[model samples]
Target: MAIWNSRFKKSFDKSALKFSSSIDIDGKLFNEDIDGSKAHVKMLMKQKIVSTSDGNSILKALEEIRNEISNGKLKFDWQKEDIHSLIEERLVEKIGERGKRLHTARSRNDQIALDERLYLRNEIKNLLKLISDFQKVLQKCLDALPEQWNMCVKLKYLTEKSGEEICQELNIAPTNYWQIVHRAKLQLRNCVENNWFKN
Candidate 1:
Protein backbone atom coordinates (compact mmCIF):
# COMPACT_ATOMS: atom_id res chain seq x y z
CA MET A 1 0.00 0.00 0.00
CA ALA A 2 2.82 2.38 0.91
CA ILE A 3 4.72 1.60 -2.31
CA TRP A 4 1.64 2.20 -4.41
CA ASN A 5 1.05 5.49 -2.59
CA SER A 6 4.62 6.69 -3.14
CA ARG A 7 4.42 5.89 -6.83
CA PHE A 8 1.10 7.69 -7.11
CA LYS A 9 2.38 10.79 -5.35
CA LYS A 10 5.54 10.87 -7.48
CA SER A 11 3.48 10.53 -10.65
CA PHE A 12 1.27 13.39 -9.49
CA ASP A 13 4.22 15.66 -8.66
CA LYS A 14 5.73 14.95 -12.07
CA SER A 15 2.45 15.55 -13.87
CA ALA A 16 1.84 18.73 -11.90
CA LEU A 17 4.64 20.34 -13.88
CA LYS A 18 2.93 19.59 -17.20
CA PHE A 19 -0.80 20.04 -16.69
CA SER A 20 -2.67 23.17 -15.67
CA SER A 21 -5.82 22.46 -13.66
CA SER A 22 -9.39 23.36 -14.65
CA ILE A 23 -9.99 23.91 -10.92
CA ASP A 24 -9.01 27.51 -11.45
CA ILE A 25 -12.00 27.83 -13.77
CA ASP A 26 -14.23 25.30 -12.00
CA GLY A 27 -13.30 25.36 -8.32
CA LYS A 28 -16.88 24.66 -7.27
CA LEU A 29 -15.94 20.97 -7.34
CA PHE A 30 -14.12 21.29 -4.02
CA ASN A 31 -17.12 20.28 -1.92
CA GLU A 32 -17.92 17.28 -4.07
CA ASP A 33 -14.33 16.14 -4.03
CA ILE A 34 -14.34 16.14 -0.27
CA ASP A 35 -17.61 14.22 -0.15
CA GLY A 36 -16.29 11.63 -2.59
CA SER A 37 -13.22 11.08 -0.45
CA LYS A 38 -15.43 10.52 2.59
CA ALA A 39 -17.46 7.91 0.76
CA HIS A 40 -14.35 6.26 -0.68
CA VAL A 41 -12.81 5.90 2.75
CA LYS A 42 -16.00 4.27 4.00
CA MET A 43 -15.86 1.80 1.13
CA LEU A 44 -12.21 1.08 1.79
CA MET A 45 -12.99 0.26 5.41
CA LYS A 46 -15.90 -1.97 4.45
CA GLN A 47 -13.59 -3.93 2.15
CA LYS A 48 -10.97 -4.19 4.92
CA ILE A 49 -8.48 -2.43 2.67
CA VAL A 50 -7.75 0.05 5.47
CA SER A 51 -8.14 -0.25 9.20
CA THR A 52 -11.17 1.45 10.72
CA SER A 53 -8.97 3.71 12.81
CA ASP A 54 -7.00 4.90 9.80
CA GLY A 55 -10.20 5.36 7.81
CA ASN A 56 -11.70 7.54 10.52
CA SER A 57 -8.46 9.54 10.77
CA ILE A 58 -8.42 10.10 7.03
CA LEU A 59 -12.04 11.21 7.03
CA LYS A 60 -11.46 13.69 9.85
CA ALA A 61 -8.36 15.09 8.19
CA LEU A 62 -10.15 15.47 4.87
CA GLU A 63 -13.02 17.26 6.55
CA GLU A 64 -10.62 19.68 8.24
CA ILE A 65 -8.84 20.32 4.94
CA ARG A 66 -12.20 20.88 3.22
CA ASN A 67 -13.24 23.43 5.82
CA GLU A 68 -9.87 25.19 5.63
CA ILE A 69 -10.05 25.44 1.86
CA SER A 70 -13.67 26.59 1.93
CA ASN A 71 -13.03 29.25 4.60
CA GLY A 72 -9.99 30.58 2.67
CA LYS A 73 -7.40 29.35 5.20
CA LEU A 74 -5.95 27.33 2.33
CA LYS A 75 -5.58 28.36 -1.28
CA PHE A 76 -5.48 26.19 -4.37
CA ASP A 77 -1.98 25.33 -5.56
CA TRP A 78 -2.42 25.38 -9.31
CA GLN A 79 1.07 24.03 -9.83
CA LYS A 80 0.17 20.94 -7.78
CA GLU A 81 -1.48 19.52 -10.92
CA ASP A 82 -5.02 18.65 -9.79
CA ILE A 83 -7.44 18.65 -6.86
CA HIS A 84 -6.71 15.02 -5.94
CA SER A 85 -2.96 15.61 -5.62
CA LEU A 86 -3.57 18.79 -3.71
CA ILE A 87 -5.77 16.86 -1.26
CA GLU A 88 -3.41 13.89 -0.91
CA GLU A 89 -0.44 16.19 -0.29
CA ARG A 90 -2.38 18.01 2.40
CA LEU A 91 -3.43 14.71 4.02
CA VAL A 92 0.18 13.50 4.20
CA GLU A 93 1.19 16.76 5.79
CA LYS A 94 -1.59 16.50 8.37
CA ILE A 95 -1.56 12.78 9.30
CA GLY A 96 2.00 11.62 8.68
CA GLU A 97 2.31 7.85 7.91
CA ARG A 98 -1.42 7.13 8.09
CA GLY A 99 -2.23 9.55 5.27
CA LYS A 100 -0.28 7.30 2.90
CA ARG A 101 -2.98 4.66 3.25
CA LEU A 102 -5.85 6.86 2.04
CA HIS A 103 -5.38 6.05 -1.61
CA THR A 104 -5.28 2.27 -1.24
CA ALA A 105 -7.33 1.16 -4.25
CA ARG A 106 -8.14 4.25 -6.30
CA SER A 107 -6.46 5.64 -9.40
CA ARG A 108 -6.23 9.40 -9.87
CA ASN A 109 -8.10 9.14 -13.17
CA ASP A 110 -11.20 7.57 -11.57
CA GLN A 111 -10.98 9.80 -8.51
CA ILE A 112 -11.04 13.07 -10.44
CA ALA A 113 -13.76 11.96 -12.85
CA LEU A 114 -16.01 10.88 -9.97
CA ASP A 115 -15.47 14.14 -8.16
CA GLU A 116 -16.34 16.24 -11.24
CA ARG A 117 -19.50 14.26 -12.03
CA LEU A 118 -20.72 14.50 -8.43
CA TYR A 119 -20.03 18.24 -8.42
CA LEU A 120 -21.90 18.84 -11.67
CA ARG A 121 -24.87 16.75 -10.49
CA ASN A 122 -25.11 18.83 -7.30
CA GLU A 123 -24.78 22.11 -9.21
CA ILE A 124 -27.60 21.14 -11.58
CA LYS A 125 -29.90 20.41 -8.66
CA ASN A 126 -29.12 23.79 -7.10
CA LEU A 127 -29.71 25.64 -10.38
CA LEU A 128 -33.06 23.91 -10.89
CA LYS A 129 -34.18 24.94 -7.39
CA LEU A 130 -33.11 28.52 -8.03
CA ILE A 131 -35.09 28.63 -11.28
CA SER A 132 -38.17 27.29 -9.52
CA ASP A 133 -37.82 29.91 -6.79
CA PHE A 134 -37.38 32.65 -9.39
CA GLN A 135 -40.56 31.55 -11.15
CA LYS A 136 -42.51 31.57 -7.89
CA VAL A 137 -41.19 35.06 -7.11
CA LEU A 138 -42.15 36.31 -10.57
CA GLN A 139 -45.68 34.98 -10.21
CA LYS A 140 -46.02 36.53 -6.77
CA CYS A 141 -44.75 39.89 -8.04
CA LEU A 142 -47.36 39.83 -10.84
CA ASP A 143 -50.16 39.05 -8.37
CA ALA A 144 -49.19 41.77 -5.86
CA LEU A 145 -49.37 44.94 -7.94
CA PRO A 146 -52.54 47.04 -7.39
CA GLU A 147 -55.02 46.54 -10.28
CA GLN A 148 -54.55 50.16 -11.44
CA TRP A 149 -50.75 49.88 -11.29
CA ASN A 150 -50.88 46.48 -12.97
CA MET A 151 -52.80 47.99 -15.89
CA CYS A 152 -50.88 51.31 -16.00
CA VAL A 153 -49.06 52.11 -19.22
CA LYS A 154 -45.86 52.92 -17.30
CA LEU A 155 -45.99 49.63 -15.39
CA LYS A 156 -46.46 47.80 -18.68
CA TYR A 157 -43.44 49.58 -20.14
CA LEU A 158 -41.31 48.75 -17.09
CA THR A 159 -42.38 45.11 -17.13
CA GLU A 160 -41.46 44.80 -20.77
CA LYS A 161 -37.94 46.04 -20.08
CA SER A 162 -35.13 43.92 -18.64
CA GLY A 163 -35.00 43.90 -14.85
CA GLU A 164 -31.83 45.98 -14.84
CA GLU A 165 -33.36 48.53 -17.20
CA ILE A 166 -36.55 48.66 -15.18
CA CYS A 167 -34.63 49.27 -11.96
CA GLN A 168 -32.60 52.01 -13.61
CA GLU A 169 -35.74 53.66 -15.03
CA LEU A 170 -37.36 53.71 -11.57
CA ASN A 171 -34.19 55.12 -9.96
CA ILE A 172 -34.17 52.04 -7.73
CA ALA A 173 -30.95 50.36 -6.65
CA PRO A 174 -30.57 46.69 -7.49
CA THR A 175 -30.61 45.75 -3.80
CA ASN A 176 -33.79 47.75 -3.26
CA TYR A 177 -35.47 46.01 -6.18
CA TRP A 178 -34.53 42.60 -4.81
CA GLN A 179 -35.82 43.49 -1.36
CA ILE A 180 -39.10 44.83 -2.75
CA VAL A 181 -39.57 41.77 -4.91
CA HIS A 182 -38.96 39.43 -1.99
CA ARG A 183 -41.35 41.33 0.33
CA ALA A 184 -44.02 41.55 -2.35
CA LYS A 185 -43.87 37.76 -2.74
CA LEU A 186 -44.40 37.26 0.98
CA GLN A 187 -47.31 39.71 1.05
CA LEU A 188 -48.93 38.05 -1.93
CA ARG A 189 -48.84 34.72 -0.12
CA ASN A 190 -50.48 36.30 2.91
CA CYS A 191 -53.19 37.93 0.79
CA VAL A 192 -54.02 34.69 -0.97
CA GLU A 193 -54.33 32.82 2.32
CA ASN A 194 -56.56 35.48 3.84
CA ASN A 195 -58.91 35.54 0.83
CA TRP A 196 -59.07 31.74 0.73
CA PHE A 197 -60.03 31.59 4.41
CA LYS A 198 -62.69 34.31 4.01
CA ASN A 199 -64.23 32.59 1.00
Candidate 2:
Protein backbone atom coordinates (compact mmCIF):
# COMPACT_ATOMS: atom_id res chain seq x y z
CA MET A 1 0.00 0.00 0.00
CA ALA A 2 1.01 3.63 -0.59
CA ILE A 3 2.20 5.77 2.36
CA TRP A 4 -1.14 7.59 2.70
CA ASN A 5 -3.22 4.40 2.48
CA SER A 6 -3.81 4.32 6.24
CA ARG A 7 -6.57 6.93 5.87
CA PHE A 8 -8.67 4.60 3.70
CA LYS A 9 -10.48 1.40 4.69
CA LYS A 10 -9.20 -0.74 1.82
CA SER A 11 -6.51 -0.62 -0.85
CA PHE A 12 -7.36 1.73 -3.71
CA ASP A 13 -8.06 0.23 -7.13
CA LYS A 14 -5.06 -0.18 -9.42
CA SER A 15 -6.78 1.65 -12.27
CA ALA A 16 -7.70 4.56 -9.98
CA LEU A 17 -4.09 4.75 -8.76
CA LYS A 18 -2.80 4.75 -12.34
CA PHE A 19 -5.28 7.43 -13.43
CA SER A 20 -4.60 9.74 -10.48
CA SER A 21 -0.81 9.32 -10.53
CA SER A 22 1.27 12.39 -11.53
CA ILE A 23 4.62 10.58 -11.63
CA ASP A 24 4.90 10.74 -15.40
CA ILE A 25 4.56 14.54 -15.48
CA ASP A 26 6.37 15.35 -12.24
CA GLY A 27 9.22 12.86 -12.54
CA LYS A 28 11.32 15.28 -14.57
CA LEU A 29 11.11 17.71 -11.65
CA PHE A 30 13.12 15.49 -9.30
CA ASN A 31 15.88 18.03 -8.76
CA GLU A 32 13.46 20.84 -7.94
CA ASP A 33 11.58 18.59 -5.55
CA ILE A 34 14.74 17.56 -3.71
CA ASP A 35 15.98 21.15 -3.42
CA GLY A 36 12.65 22.28 -1.98
CA SER A 37 12.78 19.46 0.56
CA LYS A 38 16.26 20.47 1.61
CA ALA A 39 15.03 24.03 2.18
CA HIS A 40 12.02 22.77 4.16
CA VAL A 41 14.19 20.60 6.38
CA LYS A 42 16.52 23.51 7.12
CA MET A 43 13.54 25.71 8.06
CA LEU A 44 12.16 22.99 10.34
CA MET A 45 15.52 22.85 12.12
CA LYS A 46 15.56 26.65 12.48
CA GLN A 47 12.09 26.65 14.09
CA LYS A 48 13.07 23.69 16.34
CA ILE A 49 10.51 21.55 14.59
CA VAL A 50 12.99 18.76 13.86
CA SER A 51 16.28 18.01 15.59
CA THR A 52 19.54 19.23 13.96
CA SER A 53 20.95 15.69 13.75
CA ASP A 54 17.88 14.53 11.79
CA GLY A 55 18.02 17.57 9.52
CA ASN A 56 21.68 16.95 8.76
CA SER A 57 21.04 13.31 8.03
CA ILE A 58 18.15 14.22 5.73
CA LEU A 59 20.28 16.77 3.85
CA LYS A 60 23.06 14.24 3.41
CA ALA A 61 20.70 11.59 2.06
CA LEU A 62 19.01 14.08 -0.28
CA GLU A 63 22.41 14.95 -1.75
CA GLU A 64 23.20 11.28 -2.27
CA ILE A 65 19.86 10.76 -4.03
CA ARG A 66 20.49 13.77 -6.28
CA ASN A 67 23.94 12.49 -7.27
CA GLU A 68 22.60 8.98 -7.83
CA ILE A 69 19.89 10.27 -10.16
CA SER A 70 22.33 12.47 -12.07
CA ASN A 71 24.81 9.61 -12.53
CA GLY A 72 22.12 7.22 -13.86
CA LYS A 73 22.41 4.97 -10.82
CA LEU A 74 18.91 5.67 -9.50
CA LYS A 75 15.65 4.73 -11.15
CA PHE A 76 12.51 5.94 -9.40
CA ASP A 77 9.53 3.63 -8.92
CA TRP A 78 6.77 5.34 -10.91
CA GLN A 79 4.14 3.45 -8.88
CA LYS A 80 4.75 5.90 -6.01
CA GLU A 81 2.39 8.54 -7.52
CA ASP A 82 4.62 11.65 -7.67
CA ILE A 83 8.20 12.88 -7.13
CA HIS A 84 7.33 14.23 -3.65
CA SER A 85 6.20 10.86 -2.32
CA LEU A 86 9.01 9.06 -4.09
CA ILE A 87 11.66 11.27 -2.42
CA GLU A 88 9.99 10.98 0.97
CA GLU A 89 9.92 7.22 0.67
CA ARG A 90 13.58 7.10 -0.31
CA LEU A 91 14.45 9.47 2.55
CA VAL A 92 12.66 7.29 5.10
CA GLU A 93 14.43 4.22 3.76
CA LYS A 94 17.75 6.03 4.22
CA ILE A 95 17.22 7.54 7.72
CA GLY A 96 14.41 5.56 9.37
CA GLU A 97 12.11 7.80 11.50
CA ARG A 98 13.78 11.14 10.67
CA GLY A 99 12.57 11.10 7.06
CA LYS A 100 8.94 11.22 8.25
CA ARG A 101 9.52 14.57 9.93
CA LEU A 102 10.69 16.25 6.69
CA HIS A 103 7.07 17.02 5.77
CA THR A 104 6.15 18.56 9.14
CA ALA A 105 4.50 21.82 8.00
CA ARG A 106 4.12 21.22 4.25
CA SER A 107 1.35 19.88 2.03
CA ARG A 108 1.38 18.13 -1.36
CA ASN A 109 -0.28 21.07 -3.13
CA ASP A 110 2.26 23.62 -1.84
CA GLN A 111 5.22 21.31 -2.58
CA ILE A 112 4.13 20.70 -6.18
CA ALA A 113 3.51 24.40 -6.78
CA LEU A 114 6.92 25.34 -5.32
CA ASP A 115 8.70 22.81 -7.54
CA GLU A 116 6.95 24.14 -10.67
CA ARG A 117 7.86 27.73 -9.78
CA LEU A 118 11.51 26.76 -9.30
CA TYR A 119 11.56 24.97 -12.65
CA LEU A 120 10.07 27.99 -14.44
CA ARG A 121 12.50 30.32 -12.68
CA ASN A 122 15.41 28.24 -14.00
CA GLU A 123 13.98 28.13 -17.55
CA ILE A 124 13.52 31.92 -17.54
CA LYS A 125 17.16 32.43 -16.53
CA ASN A 126 18.34 30.23 -19.42
CA LEU A 127 16.12 32.06 -21.93
CA LEU A 128 17.36 35.46 -20.74
CA LYS A 129 20.99 34.37 -21.25
CA LEU A 130 20.17 33.18 -24.78
CA ILE A 131 18.45 36.50 -25.58
CA SER A 132 21.44 38.46 -24.29
CA ASP A 133 23.84 36.43 -26.47
CA PHE A 134 21.63 36.97 -29.58
CA GLN A 135 21.52 40.71 -28.89
CA LYS A 136 25.35 40.87 -28.92
CA VAL A 137 25.42 39.15 -32.31
CA LEU A 138 22.79 41.56 -33.62
CA GLN A 139 24.83 44.56 -32.40
CA LYS A 140 27.89 43.20 -34.21
CA CYS A 141 25.89 42.94 -37.45
CA LEU A 142 24.63 46.52 -37.07
CA ASP A 143 28.07 47.93 -36.18
CA ALA A 144 29.64 46.50 -39.38
CA LEU A 145 27.33 48.64 -41.54
CA PRO A 146 27.50 52.34 -42.63
CA GLU A 147 26.19 55.05 -40.22
CA GLN A 148 22.84 55.77 -41.97
CA TRP A 149 22.13 52.08 -42.61
CA ASN A 150 23.01 51.22 -38.97
CA MET A 151 20.55 53.82 -37.60
CA CYS A 152 17.81 52.60 -39.95
CA VAL A 153 18.38 48.97 -38.92
CA LYS A 154 18.33 49.84 -35.19
CA LEU A 155 15.20 52.01 -35.46
CA LYS A 156 13.27 49.62 -37.70
CA TYR A 157 14.38 46.12 -36.69
CA LEU A 158 15.89 46.42 -33.20
CA THR A 159 13.73 49.17 -31.66
CA GLU A 160 10.67 47.85 -33.59
CA LYS A 161 9.50 51.41 -34.35
CA SER A 162 7.10 51.73 -37.28
CA GLY A 163 8.20 53.39 -40.53
CA GLU A 164 6.12 56.53 -39.89
CA GLU A 165 7.48 56.86 -36.36
CA ILE A 166 11.08 56.41 -37.48
CA CYS A 167 10.63 58.84 -40.36
CA GLN A 168 9.14 61.46 -38.04
CA GLU A 169 11.93 61.01 -35.51
CA LEU A 170 14.67 61.10 -38.17
CA ASN A 171 13.02 64.10 -39.92
CA ILE A 172 12.72 62.17 -43.23
CA ALA A 173 9.80 61.58 -45.61
CA PRO A 174 7.95 58.19 -45.74
CA THR A 175 9.29 57.34 -49.21
CA ASN A 176 12.86 58.18 -48.14
CA TYR A 177 12.40 56.03 -45.02
CA TRP A 178 11.33 52.94 -47.00
CA GLN A 179 14.20 53.45 -49.47
CA ILE A 180 16.78 53.54 -46.64
CA VAL A 181 15.20 50.57 -44.88
CA HIS A 182 15.16 48.57 -48.12
CA ARG A 183 18.84 49.25 -48.77
CA ALA A 184 19.61 48.40 -45.12
CA LYS A 185 17.86 45.03 -45.44
CA LEU A 186 19.76 44.17 -48.61
CA GLN A 187 23.07 45.11 -46.99
CA LEU A 188 22.25 43.01 -43.90
CA ARG A 189 21.33 40.03 -46.09
CA ASN A 190 24.70 40.17 -47.86
CA CYS A 191 26.54 40.75 -44.60
CA VAL A 192 24.89 37.71 -42.92
CA GLU A 193 25.43 35.49 -45.94
CA ASN A 194 29.14 36.37 -46.09
CA ASN A 195 29.89 36.38 -42.32
CA TRP A 196 27.38 33.91 -40.83
CA PHE A 197 26.57 31.50 -43.67
CA LYS A 198 29.89 31.27 -45.54
CA ASN A 199 30.44 27.93 -47.31
Candidate 3:
Protein backbone atom coordinates (compact mmCIF):
# COMPACT_ATOMS: atom_id res chain seq x y z
CA MET A 1 0.00 0.00 0.00
CA ALA A 2 1.09 3.56 -0.59
CA ILE A 3 2.10 5.67 2.40
CA TRP A 4 -0.79 8.05 1.75
CA ASN A 5 -3.28 5.22 1.27
CA SER A 6 -5.03 6.16 4.50
CA ARG A 7 -6.29 9.43 3.03
CA PHE A 8 -8.05 7.78 0.10
CA LYS A 9 -11.43 6.08 -0.01
CA LYS A 10 -10.54 3.83 -2.93
CA SER A 11 -7.46 1.82 -3.82
CA PHE A 12 -4.98 3.48 -6.15
CA ASP A 13 -5.15 2.62 -9.84
CA LYS A 14 -2.32 0.31 -10.88
CA SER A 15 -1.60 2.47 -13.91
CA ALA A 16 -1.48 5.64 -11.87
CA LEU A 17 0.79 3.98 -9.34
CA LYS A 18 3.10 3.03 -12.18
CA PHE A 19 2.85 6.50 -13.67
CA SER A 20 3.58 8.34 -10.42
CA SER A 21 6.38 6.00 -9.37
CA SER A 22 10.03 7.04 -9.43
CA ILE A 23 11.39 3.67 -8.38
CA ASP A 24 12.79 3.13 -11.84
CA ILE A 25 14.87 6.30 -11.59
CA ASP A 26 15.66 6.59 -7.88
CA GLY A 27 16.36 2.89 -7.60
CA LYS A 28 19.87 3.90 -8.59
CA LEU A 29 20.09 5.68 -5.25
CA PHE A 30 20.06 2.51 -3.13
CA ASN A 31 23.54 3.04 -1.74
CA GLU A 32 23.01 6.70 -0.91
CA ASP A 33 19.59 5.95 0.54
CA ILE A 34 20.84 3.17 2.78
CA ASP A 35 23.88 5.16 3.94
CA GLY A 36 21.81 8.23 4.78
CA SER A 37 19.26 6.10 6.65
CA LYS A 38 21.94 4.38 8.66
CA ALA A 39 23.36 7.74 9.73
CA HIS A 40 19.91 9.07 10.53
CA VAL A 41 19.10 6.01 12.60
CA LYS A 42 22.32 6.46 14.57
CA MET A 43 21.51 10.08 15.23
CA LEU A 44 18.02 9.16 16.43
CA MET A 45 19.46 6.60 18.81
CA LYS A 46 22.02 9.04 20.20
CA GLN A 47 19.39 11.67 20.83
CA LYS A 48 17.12 9.19 22.63
CA ILE A 49 14.49 9.51 19.92
CA VAL A 50 14.43 5.76 19.51
CA SER A 51 15.53 2.95 21.75
CA THR A 52 19.01 1.53 21.15
CA SER A 53 17.64 -1.97 20.65
CA ASP A 54 15.23 -0.87 17.92
CA GLY A 55 17.96 1.22 16.33
CA ASN A 56 20.30 -1.76 16.24
CA SER A 57 17.62 -3.95 14.69
CA ILE A 58 16.87 -1.34 12.04
CA LEU A 59 20.57 -0.82 11.29
CA LYS A 60 21.25 -4.53 10.97
CA ALA A 61 18.29 -4.99 8.66
CA LEU A 62 19.35 -1.98 6.58
CA GLU A 63 22.81 -3.45 6.03
CA GLU A 64 21.22 -6.74 5.13
CA ILE A 65 19.01 -5.01 2.59
CA ARG A 66 22.06 -3.23 1.19
CA ASN A 67 23.91 -6.51 0.82
CA GLU A 68 20.90 -8.19 -0.72
CA ILE A 69 20.60 -5.40 -3.27
CA SER A 70 24.34 -5.50 -3.94
CA ASN A 71 24.32 -9.25 -4.49
CA GLY A 72 21.18 -9.10 -6.65
CA LYS A 73 19.29 -11.27 -4.20
CA LEU A 74 16.69 -8.54 -3.91
CA LYS A 75 14.85 -6.79 -6.71
CA PHE A 76 13.18 -3.41 -6.62
CA ASP A 77 9.42 -3.32 -7.12
CA TRP A 78 7.73 -0.65 -9.22
CA GLN A 79 4.74 -0.33 -6.93
CA LYS A 80 6.59 1.88 -4.47
CA GLU A 81 6.49 5.64 -5.00
CA ASP A 82 10.24 5.95 -4.77
CA ILE A 83 13.40 4.34 -3.45
CA HIS A 84 12.81 5.59 0.09
CA SER A 85 9.42 3.94 0.33
CA LEU A 86 10.74 0.77 -1.24
CA ILE A 87 13.56 0.57 1.25
CA GLU A 88 11.33 1.39 4.19
CA GLU A 89 8.86 -1.23 3.08
CA ARG A 90 11.64 -3.78 2.95
CA LEU A 91 12.84 -2.62 6.35
CA VAL A 92 9.40 -3.10 7.84
CA GLU A 93 9.17 -6.59 6.41
CA LYS A 94 12.57 -7.58 7.84
CA ILE A 95 12.15 -6.37 11.43
CA GLY A 96 8.41 -5.91 11.78
CA GLU A 97 7.32 -3.01 14.05
CA ARG A 98 10.78 -1.72 14.92
CA GLY A 99 11.53 -0.97 11.27
CA LYS A 100 8.73 1.62 11.30
CA ARG A 101 10.71 3.62 13.87
CA LEU A 102 13.52 4.06 11.36
CA HIS A 103 11.57 6.89 9.75
CA THR A 104 11.40 8.90 12.94
CA ALA A 105 12.49 12.56 13.03
CA ARG A 106 12.72 12.70 9.21
CA SER A 107 10.44 12.38 6.22
CA ARG A 108 10.99 10.35 3.07
CA ASN A 109 11.37 13.71 1.30
CA ASP A 110 14.37 14.38 3.50
CA GLN A 111 15.79 11.00 2.52
CA ILE A 112 15.37 11.88 -1.14
CA ALA A 113 17.39 15.06 -0.69
CA LEU A 114 20.05 13.31 1.37
CA ASP A 115 20.40 10.53 -1.16
CA GLU A 116 20.69 13.01 -4.06
CA ARG A 117 23.37 15.02 -2.23
CA LEU A 118 25.27 11.85 -1.39
CA TYR A 119 25.01 10.66 -4.99
CA LEU A 120 26.34 14.02 -6.22
CA ARG A 121 29.14 13.90 -3.66
CA ASN A 122 30.16 10.43 -4.83
CA GLU A 123 30.02 11.51 -8.48
CA ILE A 124 32.18 14.54 -7.71
CA LYS A 125 34.72 12.30 -6.01
CA ASN A 126 34.77 10.03 -9.07
CA LEU A 127 35.19 13.07 -11.36
CA LEU A 128 38.11 14.28 -9.25
CA LYS A 129 39.70 10.84 -9.56
CA LEU A 130 39.38 10.93 -13.36
CA ILE A 131 40.98 14.37 -13.38
CA SER A 132 43.81 13.13 -11.19
CA ASP A 133 44.36 10.12 -13.45
CA PHE A 134 44.44 12.38 -16.54
CA GLN A 135 47.08 14.57 -14.87
CA LYS A 136 49.20 11.50 -14.11
CA VAL A 137 48.98 10.33 -17.71
CA LEU A 138 49.97 13.81 -18.90
CA GLN A 139 52.98 13.79 -16.56
CA LYS A 140 54.04 10.39 -17.91
CA CYS A 141 53.88 11.71 -21.48
CA LEU A 142 55.78 14.85 -20.46
CA ASP A 143 58.45 12.77 -18.70
CA ALA A 144 59.01 10.68 -21.87
CA LEU A 145 59.94 13.71 -23.97
CA PRO A 146 63.56 14.69 -24.75
CA GLU A 147 64.94 17.16 -22.18
CA GLN A 148 65.08 20.12 -24.57
CA TRP A 149 61.59 19.38 -25.92
CA ASN A 150 60.25 19.11 -22.38
CA MET A 151 61.67 22.54 -21.47
CA CYS A 152 60.38 24.15 -24.65
CA VAL A 153 56.89 22.68 -24.20
CA LYS A 154 56.75 23.76 -20.56
CA LEU A 155 57.94 27.33 -21.32
CA LYS A 156 55.57 27.66 -24.25
CA TYR A 157 52.50 26.14 -22.60
CA LEU A 158 52.84 25.91 -18.82
CA THR A 159 54.35 29.33 -18.26
CA GLU A 160 52.46 30.90 -21.22
CA LYS A 161 55.66 32.30 -22.69
CA SER A 162 55.65 33.61 -26.29
CA GLY A 163 57.35 31.60 -29.06
CA GLU A 164 60.17 34.20 -29.22
CA GLU A 165 60.58 34.13 -25.44
CA ILE A 166 60.76 30.30 -25.33
CA CYS A 167 63.33 30.29 -28.19
CA GLN A 168 65.39 32.95 -26.44
CA GLU A 169 65.23 31.08 -23.11
CA LEU A 170 66.12 27.73 -24.71
CA ASN A 171 68.74 29.39 -26.99
CA ILE A 172 67.18 27.72 -30.04
CA ALA A 173 66.21 29.35 -33.36
CA PRO A 174 62.52 30.12 -33.83
CA THR A 175 62.23 27.49 -36.61
CA ASN A 176 63.77 24.84 -34.38
CA TYR A 177 61.50 25.83 -31.52
CA TRP A 178 58.38 25.27 -33.65
CA GLN A 179 59.63 21.85 -34.80
CA ILE A 180 60.37 20.82 -31.22
CA VAL A 181 56.86 21.90 -30.18
CA HIS A 182 55.25 20.04 -33.08
CA ARG A 183 57.12 16.84 -32.32
CA ALA A 184 56.35 17.16 -28.62
CA LYS A 185 52.64 17.56 -29.38
CA LEU A 186 52.56 14.52 -31.68
CA GLN A 187 54.32 12.40 -29.07
CA LEU A 188 51.94 13.61 -26.35
CA ARG A 189 48.89 12.87 -28.47
CA ASN A 190 50.13 9.42 -29.51
CA CYS A 191 51.16 8.56 -25.94
CA VAL A 192 47.83 9.64 -24.50
CA GLU A 193 45.83 7.80 -27.15
CA ASN A 194 47.86 4.62 -26.69
CA ASN A 195 48.03 4.80 -22.90
CA TRP A 196 44.66 6.20 -21.90
CA PHE A 197 42.06 6.82 -24.60
CA LYS A 198 42.62 3.59 -26.55
CA ASN A 199 41.28 1.52 -23.71
- Listing every candidate in turn, what is its Cα RMSD in Å to the true structure after a full C-alpha superposition? 11.3, 4.4, 3.5
Candidate-wise lDDT, in order = 0.71, 0.84, 0.90
- Cα deviation at 56, candidate 3, in Å, is 2.6
Model 2: weakest 10-residue lDDT segment is: 190-199
Candidate 2: clashing pairs of residues: none
Q: Order of candidates by lDDT, top first?
A: 3, 2, 1
RMSD of 2: 4.4
- Compute the lDDT of residue 109 as modeled in candidate 3: 82
- Number of the top TM-score candidate: 3
lDDT of 3 at 129: 95
Ranking by TM-score: 3, 2, 1
Q: What's model 2's lDDT at 192? A: 63
Model 1, TM vs. native? 0.60
Q: Clashes in candidate 3: how many?
A: 0
TM-score per candidate: 0.60, 0.70, 0.75
Candidate 3 lDDT score relative to the true structure: 0.90
Better of 1 and 2 by lDDT: 2
